[model samples]
Target: MKRLSVSLSAIALIAAIPLLGGTPVLASLQKAGESIVQTLTRPQVKLNLGAEKQVVAQDQSGKEQVSWKSLEGNAVVQPGNILRYTVSSENAGDVPAKNLTVTQPIPQQMAYVLGSATNSNGAKMTYSIDNGKNFVENPTIQVKLANGKVETRPAPAEAYTHVRWRFGKSIDPTTGVKAAYEVKVK
Candidate 1:
């Protein structure tokens, strides 16, 4: 009878060992899964308009590499003059970034000169006639004529300005990106 009791006790202890060890492991796995889910669903984006500063450029490359000092001479003026500004973006994440878009609010003092924006990667540029309400490629005013009557229509607000660029490709790892354009300030 004593031997029988010892054997039964050993079997109970062996079974209990796995039960004890598995509870902690299962709990750890559950926590890890929750953490991964939270991370995947979170948004990772940082946007800010650089400080209002002046930029000046003497050459194309210098213009491309915009700086506060480079814009010293560029200002809004009447006809026969042009002003330029640069907008920059950065991939501040660990993974590759795709479909990168940069937007700049058209300063009230300037008007976007159609077809003035240039991109290094041949990106498609668009314009918004309204205050960023809508965007369209090759935006133009529509004219309706009926019985010798004509009506003019403007584009939505989300239209492109002189400095819109869509980096259709991925910005690798961690790097800063920039886009610039010349605008006529009225």
Candidate 2:
């Protein structure tokens, strides 16, 4: 009877081992599933300006290396003239980029021109009338009428101080991206 009781106890302990071990594994699997769901639902956007390729003198290794590329233009900008800079972005992750927005801070001594934005993807570009603060589709302006009534005025190109590009679909994962525009100096 003593030997039989010992054998029963050993069998019970062995069965308990699997249940105890499975708890951690199950917890880990649940955590992994939650992480995947978060990654899929989270909004992510990646920005990249195109690389510059230039010729450089050969080194002692007899191999030519690409030279430094500047983000700005090589030429100097005169006052009251436009200096264009391109800002590009791509959705490099597995999820799609929703409600895409691009903000370009106006440089000092520069004023934004109205309706000058040219989007590579037509109908995907929008202009912001209120600096870079807010964006809308076909944003309009409000005017006060002489009769104490409010009137709506179509926002002209000049009111457009910022350019925004809204993509209809998410950019492909891990793709080269770029967006550029011209800014005038006051």
Candidate 3:
């Protein structure tokens, strides 16, 4: 009789789900679900490289004006041509994501454009010259002259190996973030 009463009580508790007022029986299950969701917060990131082609077209005023068309995907490029690299990150999970950092490697055959990197999400930007071994606001290297004099000089865009973006705030759920920079083909 006691076992039967205990079984009935368990069944009653399991069936007692209220939409307006939650009961103590569902608290454990609710917390477990929340913890699992928080632990599974995943962020998706993607990168794209493109070039802008100028087209001469007549405006409404009948004057020839230059307009740009973005060319993406595998396309033939030439030296001294400008290209844009964009990095996009999004929160694909139900929870917020923190400390999102996106890194891009500047191809050896290309030179990064100085003062062209910008962040739309207000992320902190840094550069690396030692193959991404170290990152800083401005990278420098020690130069040795013929007289054995050592001097530290700022690294040029051609010397840049990588670019990094450290997000300043947490990325909210379903929020999309983008950052981009320009470079020139060698």
Candidate 4:
């Protein structure tokens, strides 16, 4: 049917943040002793992203089963429909990539599913409620109590504006890492 152009430039932006590190590797130059040549070796990560729509069905036993259909093709979704977004990354460079991070923004018309964010690389997960400027493990909001007192409480799912995952370890060359999260159409 129809092909959608889904861009994931955020991954590239995050990957490039750690470019300045050790000195470049030395290479052979002309005349074998004239001058030393420097070659920059760094991690070049590639990312692939996909979106799927969740479908629920009942079998003969009347048990509910969930299935996902790729959103790459012509797909129509209604309000309250669940959609899962997955991003896969692989390093193709000579050196390992350190402190890998991925941030995903929640659509204005969608509500994030709490506890639905997952990473295959054992990353530290954080949430952002104010666009993407700030992030915390659990975003909180101050609510005024009945007695003219204000208390801080965990922000609701609808308040989630972004989700971020930070990997503690370095990703080796050709290693694949995946992250996913679910959101519901508002």
> RMSDs, each prediction?
8.9, 10.4, 7.9, 18.1
lDDT of 3 by residue, 1-186 (tens): 999999999888777646225656478778899997767765543344445644568999999996656876776778877777777766776767778888899989999999888887899999998999999998888999999999999888899989999997888887868888878889
Model 3 residue 143 CA deviation (Å) reads 2.1
Quality of model 3 by C-alpha lDDT? 0.80
Query: Candidate 1 has what TM-score?
Result: 0.53
Quote the positional error of residue 8 for candidate 3 in Å.
33
Off by over 4 Å in 1: 1-69, 72-81, 144-163
Quick one: best lDDT, which candidate?
Answer: 4
**Global CA lDDT computed for model 4:** 0.88
Clashes of 2: 8
Q: Give candidate 3 regions above 4 Å deviation.
A: 1-68
Question: Model 4, which residues run further than 4 Å from truth?
Answer: 1-40
Residue 62 alpha-carbon offset, candidate 3, angstroms = 15
Which of candidates 1 and 2 is the stronger one according to lDDT? 2
Decide which is better by TM-score, 1 or 2. Answer: 2
- C-alpha displacement of 24 in model 1, angstroms? 15
TM-score of 2: 0.54
Candidates 1 and 4, the one with greater TM-score: 4
Q: Relative to the true structure, how large is the alpha-carbon lDDT of every model?
A: 0.61, 0.64, 0.80, 0.88
